[model samples]
Target: MIEVDCPSPAKPRVSITYCTQCQWLLRAGWMAQELLSTFRDELGEVALIPGTGGIFVIQCGADTIWDRTRDGGFPDVKTLKQRVRDRLAPERDLGHIDRP
Candidate 1:
């Protein structure tokens, strides 16, 4: 008899890469917290990656959801939540955040 390993399906993961030199750890951590809180049941994990050269990027799986330089600076909490929700759970409602 041969033994085989089978892996279960994994939930979505979010990664926030921030610049260590720029002191963005707190900011990255806060964003991770927000995502976790909002998507408690939907997400697998939230990772904080340290980088330099003023990088602040938020990625969901293999897709880059937000790039500080490309998106023009940090996103407000509301916007960040919306973007994340869109990727993780498009049909889910964000209450006040969904209101214009």
Candidate 2:
């Protein structure tokens, strides 16, 4: 028998950067938990990065999924899930999130 090499797909890493001075750790942690719960299989890891100046940004791999400054304010859980789903698995349906 001959053997062939096969490589596994690289799962995307999610990074949530929140302002430390602004005291957004809970918010960041909540977001991270949401992502991990939703994309347990799709994501490689979810990281919370402490930042300052009231920054709150979510990134998938190297792509910025959500920027609080640019987008204007924080995103709701549904919106956040949709953004992450779109980036990692556009073809995957997010149940009720996809509706309405």
Candidate 3:
């Protein structure tokens, strides 16, 4: 659930791209909080104004794996949708990926 109070408005919606190197990159189930830590205030103008709904997105090793159910913490609907999409991604277009 989003916080009840925000320092400002303008909520930040995020989309994460795993580098295939971040060992932690595994599934969308745990992406939201991960994004909050990774993207943090770096969004600049799109900065999440400490609001009820800010910061979202995540993925796993393939840049698609979606599984926002952490056994305990469940991300919001928007976060879940993105994860599902990444999970259902096309397998052939992955030609751009390279080993780090």
Point to the candidate with the largest lDDT.
1
Candidate 1: C-alpha RMSD after superposition = 5.0
Better of 1 and 2 by lDDT: 1
Find the 10 residues in a row with the least total lDDT in model 3.
Answer: 43-52
Per-residue alpha-carbon lDDT of model 2 for 8-60, expressed as tens digits?
34887889999999999999999999999999999888889999999999998
Shift in Å, residue 98, candidate 3: 11
Residue-level lDDT of model 3, residues 1-100, one tens digit each, is 7765542334334444333333334433255454454335432111211212222224333342332233234455454444433444423222223122
Runs off by more than 4 Å, candidate 3: 1-3, 15-26, 43-99
State in Å the error of residue 87, model 2: 1.3
State every prediction's TM-score relative to the real structure. Answer: 0.89, 0.88, 0.24
Q: Point out the worst 10-residue segment of candidate 1 by lDDT.
A: 4-13
Per-model clash counts, in order, read 0, 0, 4
| Local accuracy by lDDT, each model | 0.91, 0.91, 0.36
